[model samples]
Target: MSIPIWKYALSMLTYFVVLLCITELLRKKYKLANIVWICSLLTFPLWLMGGVSGWFRWAKILSVILPTIVVGFCRIANFEERKGSFWEFFQKGWILWFVYGMLFLNILEATLKDVSLGNYANAACGFLLCATIPFAPKFWEYSKTGEGDLICYTTVGWNFLYTTWNLCFVYGESPNYFASTICILMAAELYPIFKKKPELYIMSRVYTLATHMILRSCFGTMFLKVMDASTWYNASFAKYWGILNFILIIPYLFWYMWQLHTGKAEISFKRGKTNNNVTTLNT
Candidate 1:
């Protein structure tokens, strides 16, 4: 793998680099590190543009339009004072970085072999994350930088949905590389909800998360052993991931119905606090 497992691990370390960028961009600390990281990330859009076709053309054009706005807004936002977790300032950046990082790995892997390594990468990620995610929160809170950070329900919900999709269809298979990275990235987002004593529904949440993790990990491993090396698709994909997701949806619906009847449920957004406080940030 051109993207060694080490590189995947190294990608996690980039969070610190983002921290340094925050520190330097605001703290005026580690200016050199900030410059290097910025320069490194800037190369990706160029690579995308060079390979431009249908979707890539739009990506390349959006790159030009979006970065200018992002840069301008960030600069203005920081002009007065920079307060909040590095995550608050750069929360969504990680997702974009993950997408770009996957693209980078795909290109690198293809350069060395006839096939794209994206599928393997996706499988490796999904397998690893599914195996480990249930343990991460018990180890430490991923989202709480200190305290008083806004609990963004949209963020965690997006991670759950996005990773779920990726697990089912990553590398267009049962487990995916993108799913793992996303699952790991989402570790922080859930911190807001769990910072307090566990609530009644929280049990359901953890159960669902654990269920999906085990589901993905088990299916991924099973498919790996049975799979033909020539094809990334398993004939059992529908039987495995499709059926598994269907099974898991039962609990979500249960939670939804119960919460709905209680008048405490919402379609989007929930805020949690360290004091066992449940506040509605959005309905």
Candidate 2:
């Protein structure tokens, strides 16, 4: 089978351009990070709209255009600042292993292209390894305390959940889940680098809200398209799942909004030294 060369190229270009722009904003107009995120959010619904309508043609076109525009604007704005060293920023105690584990799993799935009971077993074993390994506690601590400039443990936790879902449900060779999984994972991995930077956090939360909103809306729209109102209302699984997700998301959304309003939503590094430094000492 032939690959969709143009689509792949466009996707990569969009990602690079958007990242470049966001990086610029992180340095210059830090306050506008959230706005940048809001911009990124628009792409998701366009994608879903294309998906539910089976407008693969238009979806592919949009997947490229939207990201390009968002990123281009960021680049033109030219807003970045100098900060910590990459190693200083990235070197966390325990969290590295979790990241490594994720990378490992991504590689395995990409190479293997198969998921079976055995694969699930291996994943469980890997998780166990991640938990029991000497480094696990450190990672846990880093995650909990937001050490090494880590912002929220939610970053890794969300990525883990999203990646697990993708592996379980969207493991096809040419995975449609790539955009979502990659976006989330990259954000989580970079959380440490951007930890001391509040602007980045604001942008990230905005991005998260936008992404989730688009996803939920798209799913809702798709449900409407596929099932009549009567059928949807009668479908206990869909009905309850949607309601539960909505209820759960409400508190989270409110909390995030509170943080934004209170200016607590920005990324922050730990002040002074950490007392409970459980991770390996930097060499």
Q: What TM-scores do the predictions have?
A: 0.36, 0.30
lDDT string for model 1 (1-283, tens) is 1334554455445532342233223222223323433444444444443443454324433333344233323332233234565424532334323323332333233222211333343343333333222221111122222221222232233345334534444434223334343433343233323344222122222222322233233343332233212233464652355345444444554554565468553332233334233211110
How many pairs collide in each candidate, listed in order?
A: 4, 9
Who wins the lDDT comparison?
A: 2
Error of 2 at 205 (Å): 9.8
Per-residue lDDT value at 32 in model 2:
58
Please give the lDDT score for candidate 1: 0.34
Give the range where candidate 2 is weakest over 10 consecutive residues by summed lDDT: 143-152
Worst lDDT window (10 residues) for model 1?
Answer: 133-142
Q: Candidate 1 deviates by what RMSD?
A: 13.6
Clashes in model 1: which pairs?
122-176, 122-177, 142-188, 143-188
Top-TM-score candidate index: 1
Instruction: Give the Cα-based TM-score of candidate 1 against the true structure.
Output: 0.36
